[model samples]
Target: MNTYRKTFKFDAEFPFEYKYRDATSAQFELPNHVHDWYEFVYIYSGRGTFFIDHSFYDAEAGDIYLIPGNTIHHSYPVEDDPKRATAFYFSAAFVHDTSSVGEPFHYLQPFETAQSKQSFRFTVPEAYRNQIVDLIEQIHHEYSEEKVGYRQVIRMHIQHILLLLNRHAEETWGESLLRHQAAALPQWIEQTLSYIDSHLEEELGLAIFARNSAVTPAHFSRVFKRLTGMNVTEYVTAKRVMRAKEMLRLNDRNIAQIAEACGFGSIPHFHRKFKALTGMTPAQYKHSL
Candidate 1:
């Protein structure tokens, strides 16, 4: 078992990190894990599957994924197609302190309030995608070169990207989908996620989930898919895995106890799914922790 966990620290010396990778025709496998810093990934080309928390989305070019601190996730190439992406990682403290210096404070809203539905993926328009890519490239360059005032330039670019993305989201989905969400759908989704989180020990069947959403089973299925990009079973399984991870890391309970607490019916079933999702067994995960 490769039981080496990855961790990062953000101090005065280095407050952020950026990476630009052209993963063309390579199969990269990043196991499910959490990070201390907030992460933003922009897919510049190719396609794949992005698994985060309890949802999975079809990751393609022009899609951006926001993963707040300590969220377990992993995404990789789709067979031979490859997945190229630019990643930005920073701390919430960094954003807060930087924006406190006369800049807008609302830049952290999306990240701070990243509910289940808000945490996954956003597909940007082509024009906006190009602009975002350019900005990300510039940040990467500034970080690599460390020219005069590079840190300030990088901070400015980060704020610019956030503001632009906020505007794009407001114009694109906020007016329509968000307006509807504010009315009911968003609340419904939030409540549903909360219910799942709180009731992990119960038998969370389709009908029960549908009832929580205030819709028929069929309609609930459709709406949930449209909103979350994952079906009920997948979402439930992902949530179970996330909880199991937490237990493995924090509790001294045996594997079977953690499995039962996480809603896995049997130890074997739990072991299989845990390995499949996390690329490690419960024992290995605990050892890594």
Candidate 2:
């Protein structure tokens, strides 16, 4: 019941957050939730089960996971031997702004691939594990100190880490270790998610979906919340807003047009929801880009 969307007030100039957990415990267990920032997690020691998207993966020392923005995930640490891990979170804008022309490097390729395949965990070759850890630690130190030029140095380290991961993904493409099978979701839930994505411009209601699934509205509401960590209304609103954002980025359409295209009832309602989730009005978000 405590599951809800999480938001962080990242620094406008440098939108990155880092954390290290010495030992995870019951009190630290996170319920299923989603966030609007990409995440990179490095397991330093111990063991755990990580639920990412629709899959559960066994996590152990030296394992790494890349989670794209707005993905549902949670971790369950083994009681006797909890996981000690480091997490790095950064905005998509941070990656796009740092990327240069003709670099032949798409920093987000690994994350994109993981999202497409629903496989987010990986391990670098034994020889490269220490190097990756060192770079992550350097990012932690620079971020903690906040000395002069720390922002630039931290950015360098993050890009370096991503570059290494992307290379590993390319080298190991289609390998068994890189393609863990995800647990299948309930048929109705999976179909509902796909339906929502394809029909964002149409009216979406719990009653409609419930009827389609041959369940009572109240029953459908409870089960949807339990499975997705979000109620039907919240999920639909989030999807509409996400689509609006893409429209804002890809075209010069007016806010009102974009809002209508995304099935918002009105401009004011769209503005309210967009600012609530993204911390900025639709116009402000467009201008920020």
TM-score of each prediction = 0.60, 0.76
Count clashing residue pairs in model 2. 0
Q: What is the lDDT for 20 in model 2?
A: 72
Name the candidate that leads on lDDT.
2
Off by over 4 Å in 1: 1-5, 9-11, 24-27, 97-104, 113-119, 172-196, 201-289
lDDT of 1 by residue, 147-258 (tens): 9998888888887787777777667654321111122345666678768888887799779978767779998888776555557887777678778887877778999999
What 10-residue stretch in candidate 2 is worst by lDDT? 174-183
State candidate 2's TM-score: 0.76
- Model 1 — which ten-residue stretch has the worst lDDT? 175-184
Please give the RMSD to the true structure for each candidate, in Å: 8.4, 3.8
TM-score leader? 2
Writing each residue's lDDT as its tens digit, candidate 2 over 1-289 gives 4334677777788888878766779577667666778999999899878867656678879888999986767787889999999998998777775546766677887898787776889778876678889998788788789899999998888888888887777777736326473445467776777788778889999988998888899988987776666688887887787788779988989999999999999999999988876778999978977
Native-vs-model 2 lDDT?
A: 0.79
How far in Å is the alpha carbon of 158 misplaced in model 1?
A: 1.2
Off by over 4 Å in 2: 1-13, 22-36, 45-62, 69-83, 92-103, 116-119, 142-151, 174-181, 214-219
